[model samples]
Target: MRIGLFVACITDSLYPATARATVRVLERLGHTVVYPAAQTCCGQVHYTSGYRREAASLAGRFADVFSGCELVVTPSASCAAMVRTGYPRLAAREPRAADAPRVLELSEFLVDVAGVTDVGAHFPHRVTYHPTCHALRSLDVGDRPLRLLRAVRGLELAELPAADECCGFGTTFAWKNADTSVAIVADKIRHIGATGADVVCALDDACLTQIDGALSRLRGGVRALHLAEILAAGDPAGDR
Candidate 1:
């Protein structure tokens, strides 16, 4: 399948490794991955920030960028959720923006669309998965990430305590509600530390950033990894 990779702004800027890992994993699966130069934000930040006009315009641009692709996949579950759920509503009144590309989060495309569990990944360390709020509640990508991790060679999957809880990085919510966000992620970090895992994995970079901040400041010793980065392990090109 020729899949268009919608590298979200966060992944493109802060976590370029995740985007590279995504490409590595997809190509390893014998799929042709294409990156459309015109692709931009999925309008998630603006929509959630109550700037509907700006959000709708970006949503239309997003649709136009990947218009011809059969399937659009993104590493960030947060952005994927926005594209699939937010775009239609934002573009409801525009005839040109009526159709949006079929957008799927990486795990969704791998497990449901590609019909593969193991991407031949190898990581010799104990790892726990923290399902981001978008992945858990918005996208409802239940257990797909875990299923893939379970199939990894030499990787141990530990269940995170209160795994369904938010990491408190709801985009602007983290900045706007500093105290509450800190408290929520404090609990999340505590749970992550309890697992005794070397790495904590999630589908979205936003949550990883939130979790990583606490883990770093507290010196919790647990590293945050995007699912694609973990799955890209043991490749001939090596993990990014």
Candidate 2:
């Protein structure tokens, strides 16, 4: 399968390894992973921050760059959801610029398109899951990633209390209201600590950054790991 990787701005800049792992996982699956270097922000930040006109401009650029790919895959679920769910909303407002390709989150492509039951990967750690907002409500990718994670060899999947709840990081939602953000994140940290998982895995970097930062601040001590990093851990012999 020829797959185009849309390494979204956040992952491309702040979390490059997540983007790297996305490639590694696909390449290991015997697929051609193409990095669309022309990709940039999905205009989500602008739109959500009340700059609709600017958002339309940026979303147009993203559509132009993403048009060529047959199947676009991205690591960050929020960006993917922005392109999938949010871009269409922007298009409705600015009908002149709506000829964009739809984007798919990694979990969506893996489960629906790739028809993968068990990706041959292994990690022997006890982990809890955090379902990112866009990944959950926006993209509607519920338990697809969890289903895959549960299949990994030697992994112990611990149920996250209020697993589907937001981790208080709504991409600037935290930055704007620091007090509320910290308060909400504090609750998430307590829930995570009670589970006693060594790691908390999710598909969104924003939530990971927010919750993991609180973990560090409160010294809760559970590390946040991206699902792509775990997916990249397949055995060399193709027998994970």
TM-score of each: 0.98, 0.93
Residues 82-191, candidate 1: write the lDDT tens digits: 98788778766544455778889999999999999999999999999999888998899999999999999999999998888888989999999999999999999889
lDDT on C-alpha atoms for all candidate structures = 0.90, 0.81
Candidate 2, residue 38: Cα displacement in angstroms equals 1.8
How much is the lDDT of residue 227 in candidate 2? Answer: 90
- Model 1 Cα RMSD, 1 decimal: 1.0
| Tens digits of per-residue lDDT for model 2, 152-212 | 8888989989877778888888889989988888888888988999889899887888978
- Residue clash pairs of candidate 2: none
Global Cα lDDT for candidate 1: 0.90
Give me the candidate number with maximum TM-score.
1
RMSD to native for every prediction? 1.0, 2.3
lDDT, model 1, position 228? 95
